[model samples]
Target chain A: MKLWEQNIRKVKPYVPGLQPKEDNIIKLNTNENPYPPAPGVERVMEQMKLDKLRLYPDYDSTELVNELAKEKRVDPEQIFIGVGSDDVLGMAFLTYFNSDKPVLFPDITYSFYDVWCELYKIPYERPMLDENFRIVKQDYYKENGGVVIANPNAPTSICESTEFIRDILEHNQDVVVIVDEAYVDFGGASSIDLLKEYDNLLVVQTFSKSRSLAGLRIGYAIGNKELIEALNIVKFSYNSYTMNTASIVLGAEAVRDKEYFQNTVNQIIEQREKTIQELDELGFTCLDSKANFVFATHKSVPAGKIYEELQKKKIYVRYFNKPRINNFLRITIGTEEEMNQLIIALGEIL
Target chain B: MKLWEQNIRKVKPYVPGLQPKEDNIIKLNTNENPYPPAPGVERVMEQMKLDKLRLYPDYDSTELVNELAKEKRVDPEQIFIGVGSDDVLGMAFLTYFNSDKPVLFPDITYSFYDVWCELYKIPYERPMLDENFRIVKQDYYKENGGVVIANPNAPTSICESTEFIRDILEHNQDVVVIVDEAYVDFGGASSIDLLKEYDNLLVVQTFSKSRSLAGLRIGYAIGNKELIEALNIVKFSYNSYTMNTASIVLGAEAVRDKEYFQNTVNQIIEQREKTIQELDELGFTCLDSKANFVFATHKSVPAGKIYEELQKKKIYVRYFNKPRINNFLRITIGTEEEMNQLIIALGEIL
Candidate 1:
């Protein structure tokens, strides 16, 4: 080892999905929105004062927070915005999970959970999901430092009901429960309303998938004022100006246009349902997905072979090599035309 | 304390300068550039493709990194970009400074250094600056896990020569030494050249000061390939897509216009020298500033009073109430007209 590397903390970094430079490929590995952001976003960007780049952005992210609060029907004090949902979730991990006991999360959830636990030296336990890839709430009843549930979990694309989440929260009233709702806007119910009942609950959502601003990187969390305050403390300590001016301004513009947001979300949901039925007809055992993606495994084909074959045709879908889910493929739902192409490609492959 | 607050790590957050929403104020508290970003930046903003935001930004910031590599005359492998210099420095602290020995920095330097140490649970020692507010190189010769020297250090507005930095690096060859050149573009010489001699040297810089893109939040570090890789490991593990799409494109455009950058930098340096002479004429003992700011203490007046008086008149400057430097005010260099108005205000106050 190099002399400087002897004592530093080191961990294997997470590999994000391929962001192909070429434009002709069907990109579905990462669950990014397939539509453009709200029309107001473009207008705001056009009218933005380039001169303002000389000054620092608002440290509080006042405009974005205000817009989110107004949209979610919560007071502005209950909201916290960051560069992306990953940033918000990372800050949450740093702030709330500090006890000696291990935090509890689902084994088959967003892979970042374990990576974060390791980074912060926070002990954690991953309770196994049921055979159907659903969260088992009773497993969280045991002691834990905190709880993180990625609602409509990644890779599985299965969402748990809020009532089930309520049960988990009730059983563990002392620990902070972070319900990451990155995919909730597609079809799953949001846990935002439960914030009124549980002071320990934090619901994290992102504009990347639903608002179509993945490249802009705006994510937020809604919770009780105290929870938000704790997050603010951590954020300020880490990087005070986490959100830049364009993101704060354009994100607020995107949030204010409710009709555009809802219209795009409905379109995505319709496309996702159609894609699932088509995959099912091709002899794929697909999960009951409430997210913007479908998780399916073919009845007679190895997922690795199918993934390689699809890649040759410039069609990309996420295929994890981990245990218990190696045979499944997670495909992001695109526009109707894109989905039609994806179906045709799958038909040829099968 | 609330139930969720038990045994969690907490630190007093760093307080940044005020970012007032009103447009009429002559904002000078934060050390921001007075001129706008390069004209190319405005063009990039105008021609921005709003459609691409639906996809994620390049995880590696490929284009920005390539641009920076060409501009800095360094290999792309030797660069690590971040949201701001704060993010770059924060990641450096997490990646290096892991041994049992305390990290070392100047006591009266940038306040965020101490906050980052506390946040990462790294032990650190602050060596007192000499009476002239210059770094004492001998003080850093003793054992340390790592060292951070802010060239043309903030609040003090004084710089240490690269020869002095070399002496410190010679004594401590095993640990990482970060030479933060945030204000190097104004008048101070950069330690970037020393990277050829020392494998452990890391030079950090930002676009916020000389480039006039504080609102865009772009910062970078240039080091040996190994150190850059170490920072990348930590950054990717923390947040893969830290740089948003706009920052990547606009920051690169800002870097590409060499003539514009040099012109603005020269203007700032000229204004800084004039501002120092004026402050000296006004019975203030101003430090020999090599930065875009002037640090001065009035011979007969208190800095706190001057700060408050300037605030009353809609002119803002930074005043820290810390020990040994309580009388000093760090005034950011503004345009010639703005500086003249500031001089008039100071004359009346004194």
Candidate 2:
């Protein structure tokens, strides 16, 4: 037996969306921003002093949290930053989901939630989404150790309203509720507005989608100071300097340029609407998406066949081979021209 | 009572070296490289396309691992990258040190070892070092689930020979033996040389000390393919994209420029020699240090007092308040002028 095999947890790792090996491909599989980061990002990259890199970064990510607090209109103590939203959410799971009662989440949301639960040995139950790919608010009224819901749920691309989330929070007052808004910038109403009313609410957002800084690995959580402290304690024990200097500096600049962020978000929303209309015309069933991607299935073609055909045409979209959603394709909105190419290629494939 | 307070692991998080808020201070607290990164690092930063920030980085650190394998004379399959060495070692503890038998480490080794054990809920025993502060190889003859030793052990600054490490490995064939070479570039013999003879040995090194990339957050482990696969399994399950793109791109550049890495290492070794001689003249008991820093105690002065006096002079050195090391201080070697200033300040304090 291998020495490492003794205690290693056997985990089926979450397979991220296909990142194309070849360039010049109309990539729409991962829900990444189709536009470049804010113009200030380039400026931050240029102005960063390579000399200061000899020392460690600020252990608390003080400046980034301060800037985010300013933009989000919260106390600096309410923010917890990590390498990415996955890191933030993973740490949150370890910190708050330790009760003997089973934690809860949507069965078909971002797949990483279940993986984290397994990694930490947290008992969790997946509540099924309705046939319309929407969360049933009534199902979450039962007792749970904790809860997490991806606003504008992944792959399905349907978001629950802030009031619906608040209703769930109202019932689950004793347990922490995590609202992952990874793709909320497109059109979904954020639960950050509910943070004031619900102390148990933890709202997580990322620069990966709306701010276009996925390569920089910046993500954060906004919650009550007590919850944020719990995260910081775990983070400090795990790794003191989680964020690199380049990311902290550049992420701050990305957030500071609100106009550029808004413009890019607007462009993606416009393209998503156009793509939804085009998909409907092509005789496909498309969900009313509030994210950077559209969830659709052709009336006649199998989703796998469409995915394979799109690969041959150098266009990529996400397709899960799991039950209930195996027939659907989650197509990330790309540039208008790129989406146009995708549409033309799909027309031929069909 | 707060909902999360009950489950929160009441961990006294490891306190990292002070990162002073003000500039222009002589920072010798953390054993960070005094020099800047390779010239190629700047070029890599400048040439990185801002548009690529929209997409996620390669989850596996493909290019970075490829370049590192070439430099380290190992196969790409033998390498595993992390956010930093702390992140690397923490994951290793979670991966391999889970047998019912307790893991073993040096009593006066890197302080994070115990913290990691606590974080992972691993049972560990710290066998005491000899009075000379050298690891007694015979002490490790007993059975253990795993073993980790920081060569040129932190706060002691003493290195064990590769033959000595091999003796321990020879007995512990059923378990993994980890040799952390974080400061090995300063002068010590790297256990990387023993990888050919021992498949059970996992050697970890960092760019933070010798390559001047602490703020970049890059570290890696070299082991047999099976052990590496175990680490990758946990990493992929934990966080797919740990290293940000800039660290991956520039860390490769830092490794490729071997001549620059050698030049900086030599300069630090020279400064270390000069500082050790000077401290000896000041009636200090300095260890036979082979690392970037020296562990010393004044014959009559308290280590805490010296640390405070150095801080008042705007200089910093690490001091632990624990037993056995309470009287000693770990002083990182700085530029010649900075070392001279530190010596002058010590002379006045004595």
Candidate 3:
């Protein structure tokens, strides 16, 4: 090995879903919202002054944070914005997961959790999810450095109740508990209300799923002022200007049109219900999902074969080959016509 | 103390230059270009499809990276992109400075170097610059984990020759050497050509200063394929989509208009030389600067008082209150008209 190689920090990186370059394909893999962002976002983009590109963006991201604070009904001091929720969660892991005791999460949850632990050298343990793919609240009740729960968990497409979250929080009050609500807008209940009682609880959300601004890369966290201040300190230490000019201005527009935001989220939820019914009739068993996606397994056909067969028909869905969940496929809810096409494609594959 | 607070990664953040909110002020603190970005950037923004923002950006940032590789005459595999030069440098510190041995840099270089070291818990030593505020190349010849040098070092506005950089690289062949050329396009000689001989060398540059896209937050690193690969791994591990869609698309357009980039850079150089001449006549001893800024100290008045006086006249310039540089004001070069106003204001204050 080269002598300089000894100083290299090695770790496996998280592989985001395939974004096929080809235009004509059904892309339901990454859980991105099928609809475009709010109309106000388009208006903001059109009217944005390109001459301002010469100046550095506001390092504080005041406009976006103020808009979010007003929308979420939290003080501006309670919020911390980042490039995305992934960035927010990554910063949280760096800031809050420094103890020697292993941080706790479910064995089957967002795959990025463990990757972050490895990158920061934070000891972490994943307790197994129940057979129903539910986040067993008791598993996180033990003494640990910290706890992270992905409500409306990915791949499993299951969201635990607010009471379940409270149970975990009540037990782990000594450590920071991060509730990743990336999909809460679709159907999952938010733990944000619990923030009134727990200072250690951090509720993280994103623009990628419900708001349809994944391409813009905006996300934020709402918590106690002290917790947010700590996150800001670490963030500024890392990069003072994570948000850009267009993101700050356009993201504020996304927050302004509340009616358009609700309408798009409602459409996704309605389509999700209809898609689930069709999958059930096709000899497929799907978990009860409160997210923008569905997790289903055919009674006879292996998910790997079904995934490949659907790909042949220009339909894409996420299929993780990890242990215990190999039989399942996570399909994001697309438009009405797209969902019909997906149903037809699934029937043929089965 | 709160139990959860114990795990907080506490460190003093690197405070960025002031970005005043009020308009019509002579903003010259952050080293930003007075001119706008390339015309192609404006065209790209006008024609961008808002609907495509529903999908995630290309994780590889293929288009921007490919364009940059072609422009720099390097392979696509030899480049890494980030939000800004600060983000690129911070990632480099995390990826390459993992050895137990201390990293080496000049004491009077970019202020963010020590903050990054503290954030990552990396042992680092700042070898003091000579009395003239110039990096002594031999000081980096000692055994250390890595070396970083800012060509045309910030606040000091002093540029070192390519031969000086090559001398440091020759001795530190076994460790990674990062030549931060954030201000190189103005006049400083880039050490990018030395990448051919040193496998461990990484050259980082930014669009904020030369390309006039600070508001968009675009930066990149060019180096050996292995070194670039390591940076990509760490970037992906931290945030898979650090570059958003607008940044990727608009950054490519900025690179396409090479003539506009060169024209703007030439204008800034011309303004810088003129400003230095004016400052000299005003009883200020200005450093010989190759950057878009000039570091000058008044013959009688202190830098802090001069900074305050400029601000009172709505002319904002950077003043560092730290050791040695306490009496020097780093003044960014604005347009000719703005510089004339600044000279008039300084003449009155002195």
Candidate 4:
């Protein structure tokens, strides 16, 4: 019955965090920024002329790219837009990794990375994270194809230094290295600045995090023009209108409004720190997170039990039953009010 | 260099029509419908909350599918959504056609059909159309792994009767018979009704034409639940967040307002008949078109010369320099005012 490629058969689908329909829960499973996007960001959608929706979206997303180029301090030619960071990552897998060259990513990083590798039928190796659930950058440099690292890594909520990312780029000369900075807006140092020095490097970012455009499915990759061209070629071959017009417009606006962005991100950071502190004080060993989420566990309690018990109190957080982090829960940093609700629920569950 | 597949090297990169910078140029290329979308469509966009732009669009498009199902008189489960008809076609090619069975499409059909075959390394046979540029459905009963036909076929704008399509579906029980109905909303009858009798038939339609939401990228398929399941699997494995929020809302509204759609199509049909009469009298031989476009050429002049001549007057039409069709220009039918301008320009040129 599995007429699909061998890769799809062995694949484990990406499990996005649980979203509860009823509004009473303190939901923080998917690492979505609890802080709402900039008010100015929504203005772009409001301003769209629905009368013009009949025509095809501006093919190149010219204005959005221009905004991105100015925001990233990179050439417009160096940016590739996609539906989401996953779309950009999918483009990276198709464009950069051939069947002969195996792509590489951390075993414990974003689950979609593995799904993409499978879908593309590219061979890949996952270098295991250390006992502390941190990437060994030196380990990735040995005998790898393309390299990908999630900064403020998912499920672990830990960040690898830009210096280490550059080291991987330096070592992997033959293949493209993709750094997914989806959560980087939370606090992680972006490697976007390094695009000037490296042609083989692509830094993938999303407006879903800090810009709060997760609903709109807008993500982009900043790289050398040649690499960006590869993504464009793949995208053109498949879906030309990858990003919706309204989403692209809002993304450009959010990137342009630096003041609004700073204010919201500052609020999220402040909340994340307090949440992590509260969890730590309750005898949980929490990872030092640069993301708006925390991964933590206690020696006395099983992670799944805690996840379920918290759900009983109308509070939800992520619990991955995967290897290397089965005992921990990845909790999104919500607003102060939501975090307080989660903390109180956690205390009760304990 | 084409890195992955040897077949990719053979593909001529796609060049989409350049976007119109000035609004008044009588844009007719790419077969885009000339009129703007319905008034109801605009109302939905204006009413959408800008804050919703940040969140991911509904992946299932449950609401849209329900409305589409209601309109089509089919079960909601039978509806499969994709980015556009092109994306749906790409998925169909990838899913049904693989190593063992090559696809069979008409030689003069949609160009992307062949491109995807090459990209996926799926061997395909392009059966040449008959003397009148009409597809003989009997030709598909050969060794075709699958059959894809663009109804109210592109470039020619010629349509195959529902009876002829049913004959193909009735006989080709072993293969996937795909109807690319990207232009069906304009005039041609849809094969959606045939789904009850044929489990293997997949009919793909887009909101780009009738709904006038090309900028939004919404396409859907109606088929047996089994075939829908196959496409759904491919979709989930690839991009789940394919349909953004704006598209879902706009597409559903566009489908719901069938009366508005009928009015628009009737106007286009009226304009089309007038344009055809005008061209025929002006010593041009045009294909019998059932869709919203006219495929025409003057016996005295080649298509290339006409294309060049029209460019001088700022009139745009699609010309493919391929065999058999090199003499004809695919001119999308415009609004009454737009078509009058085209006629006036043609009168001056003549």
Candidate 5:
């Protein structure tokens, strides 16, 4: 009965984590930063003159690209920015992937990856993880149009080292490989250095996790000049002004202020470790994580029960009701006080 | 040789008119606002109490939609905003136009439409414009999955009246029809009213032209419940954060200050008439325009000569080399002083 393209009808959208309506909840479902962005980020917004907005923003986000180039030691031409890492990944599917070639990703990674492939009408194959919830390198050696894997993988919060990624690139020579490092700043190794060794590797990173500009919606990819140029061409042919003025300038300032940026991320890292310890002592089997969150499930109690109980008490954590992982919960690391509240809630729930 | 989706290989992007590199040119190439955005716009940016850029923005832009609904006198569910009209149109093509049916638009209109069709691999038919450089609405009724037209048509600056659009919507009952009113602010009639009777009509408009938010990257579509919901589902599955915060706030202000917006657009209308008069006096034929820009050709001089010679005198105008309209140039109406400068430059060139 629908008048839309048939493919769009079949696309089941990526469901982002719960955004609570009642603001009183602890609200740790999404892995958002517990701290504000770098102080310079706000200054960029306030100090920005409004007159410039009357003109089109640089299609490439020039200043931010140059800053990313310097920080990542990649050429400015090799960097492409989008609304977020999701947008970048979406573009990758529409531009590089197709109905003919298979898009390859981890079976148990960020759910949005599969959603994007479906939206783009690209045939995709999910490589299953090992029994320990880790990506098996041998699985990705199969032929694919491109390979995408998240580093410091979401939900599990465990990292597949850049070494494994370099080896994947070494083998998948005919295809483009994307390494999403949304949580790299929390301690996972970034594959930024592998750009010279592999021309096909596009390392996707975001300001959302580390730089704390998630609201600003800035994500970038650094790759071989050709692949980057391809993304640029695709952007121009589609929507050129994907990034707004405030988002661009503010993102650059946040990415450049490593001291203030690292201070906030490092705080979250410290909190994550302490929370993992607390959860472990509570008889939860937790993953060794490098992200701003921890993934764990208790031996005797359903994690979903704890999550719902915390929600009743005005504390929130993420619970996936999907099969094979219904008992686990993903808890984002918040400020010291917030984490302490979460721990106290867990104690009370037990 | 390039390793990209085959459909993307032939997408030639629309080259936008040249932008001002320095401050001192009589710039009228792109049809930008002769006036700045509403006073509230700048104030919103200046006083944006965003001490929190670390958190993700409202991906749905809920507050913006709520404000837009109030301004437009429609339900919040009726409006779907995008990064710009480009993003909106691109999403529309992917959602409603792709598949077995051919997407249709005017051959001479928004070149990006064809590019997007190619990007989505959507079979398309660019129905030729009438000799008068206006869209022939009847052409769109011929077995298309969707049809889009720029209502105050670009380059030629002629608008199809509300009655004419209603006629198209009457016959094309099955296919989706999009009326892009990107330049409707000067004098064109909006097709928004037809949304009452037609679930198929999506009237797309932008802040870039009349509202002067080109740099902000914001635009939206007003439609009946079903079409808007379709776009929402497409946006959710693809790029979720379609509009940024500053653009959302500023766009709402632009829509709210109807008097200011009307007065500015009316001034551009007056200036456009005056420019047409002066050009007619100097032996050039100009089209009757409903939009803010003017389209004209001189019998004695080449359009390229006029364009290049004007640039030599620090005046700019758009010159399209497309075979159908190789003799004419599209000039945007600027402030009175800028128009005077343009007049003097044209006089010297003639």
Candidate 6:
């Protein structure tokens, strides 16, 4: 080994879902929105003056924060923006998970959580989720550095109630609590309201899912002013200009077209329900899902076999080979036509 | 005080140059390029399919990296991209500066160096620059954790020779050495050629300065394949999708138009020389700058008064009120017309 290699930080980086380069395939592995961004995004992209790119974007991301504040019904000071929810959560991990105690999260949650912990060298513990893949709030009540909960957790599609979050917050008031709401807009209840009472609560949401701008890369957190301030301090210390010009301007445009945002989200929800019903008829046990995805296991067929068969037909879905989740498939809800194709592929595979 | 505040990572964040909200003012506080990005950038932005935004961008930033690799004449595996040079540098610090020993840098180098050290809790020592504000190469020859040199060092606008970088690299073979070339395209000789000899050296450059795409937020590092991999691992562990779609696409287009890139750099360099001569005539002592900006201090007038007087005339230049460099103004080279106006304004102020 090279002598300098000793100083190199060794880390097992998070593996994001496949973004298949081949076109005309049903691509639903990464839980990205299956619809285009709001119409205003295109307009803004077309009309934005290219000359202004010579200057750096506003490091504060003032306009984007103001629009998000209006949408979330929070003070502008309560909002903090990042490149995406991953960036936001990474910053949160660095900023708030500094105690000697290990931070706590569900054993099965957004995989990036522990990756952030490991990257920052922050000690963390994973409290196992119940057999139903639901967060056991009481488990988080134990003393810890902090807590992170992915509301409408990934690969499980289960969302807990605000009261459940409050229970944990009440016991863990001494540490910061991050409610990752990346999928909360997809029918799950948001814990943003809890911020009024819990100064330690930080609710992180992203435009990647409901807003259909994952490619644009915008995510934000809303919390009490102090929590947001701390997050901002960490962000500025890291990179003052994290948000680029297109993201700041186009992200606000995506937030502005409220009607289109709701329409696309509603369409995804409708299709999700239909797809879940079809899967059930095919003898697949699907978790009752609130997010824009479903977690399922076939009664007779092995998930690995079914995943292979579907992929052979150009239908993609997420399958984790890890413990407890090895037999399950996490399928992001696509458009009506795409969902139909996925259902038909699964039926044939079974 | 709040109990959770103890867990909050308190930091003195880096204050970026003021991005005034109001328009029609000459902006030079930030050393951003005055010219628009290559014309092809606008074409790409206009032609990009907005519908594809529902999906995530290529986290690897493959196309941009490939384009940059061809431009820089390096293997694709030797390159790593980030949101900007700051993000790139921040990741480098977290990845390569993990040794227990203190990192070494110039006392009056890029301000963000110390900020990153503080944020990441990396021990670092700033060796005092010579009285002429040039890096004393001997100081870095001593044992330390790692080394970071901002070629064409900021605020001082002095570019050390490739030989100077080689000397430092020859001594620090046991640790990673980061040569930040954020301003290299202006005139500075890049340490990229030395990479063939020094496996531990990593050279970072950005599109923000000479390419006139500061608003798009693209930066990269070229090094041995192993060092790039380590940087990528830390980047992926931190935020997998730091480079958004617009930045990736538009940044590639900027690279493709080599003619426009060189033209803009030449224009800025010409303007910088004329600005320096004009400032010298106005009784200002200007550094022998190889950067797009000039570091100048008035012989009789204080930098603060000149900064305020220029502001009153709707012209802005950077004036840092820190020790040792308190009386200097770092004026970015703008258009010839802008420089003339600046010279006229200085004449009147004097």
B174-201 per-residue lDDT for model 1 (tens digits) = 8999999999998898998899999999
Instruction: Name the candidate, 4 or 5, with the larger lDDT value.
Output: 5
lDDT of 3 by residue, A277-324 (tens): 999999888899899999999999999999999999989999999999
User: Proportion of native contacts in model 2?
Assistant: 0.71
Residues B1-350 of candidate 5 have per-residue lDDT tens digits of 64433423445666778866776887888887877878888887777766546666677777778877897788888988899899998888787775577878888887788888877778888889888887787887787777888988888898988999998888777778899999887889998888888888888988888887788888888887777888888899987665666666677776778888888888888988999999998888998899878889997999989989998888889999998888998998989999998888788778
The candidate that wins on DockQ is: 3
Worst 10 residues of 5 chain A by lDDT: A2-11
What is the C-alpha DockQ of each candidate?
A: 0.81, 0.75, 0.89, 0.46, 0.57, 0.88
Which regions of candidate 6 fall more than 4 Å away from where they truly are? Answer: none
Give RMSD to native, each candidate. Answer: 0.9, 1.1, 0.8, 2.5, 1.9, 0.9
Q: In candidate 3, what are the lDDT values of residues B189-254, reduced to their tens digit?
A: 998899999999999999899989999999999999999999999998989999999999999989
> Who is ahead in DockQ, 1 or 5?
1
**What TM-score would each prediction reach against the true structure?**
0.99, 0.99, 0.99, 0.95, 0.96, 0.99
Q: Candidate 5 iRMS, in Å?
A: 2.6
Q: What is the alpha-carbon lDDT for the whole of candidate 1?
A: 0.91
lDDT of 2 at B20: 90
Q: Which regions of candidate 4 deviate over 4 angstroms? A: A1-12, B1-11
DockQ, cand. 2: 0.75
Stretches > 4 Å off in candidate 1: none
Number of clashes in model 4?
A: 7
Off by over 4 Å in 3: none
Candidate 3, chain A: TM-score?
0.99
Provide the TM-score, chain A, model 5.
Answer: 0.96
Ranking by lDDT: 3, 6, 1, 2, 5, 4
Give per-residue lDDT, candidate 3, residue A46: 88
Clashing pairs in 3: none
TM-score of chain B of each: 0.98, 0.98, 0.99, 0.95, 0.95, 0.99
Distance from true position, residue A197, model 5, in Å?
0.8
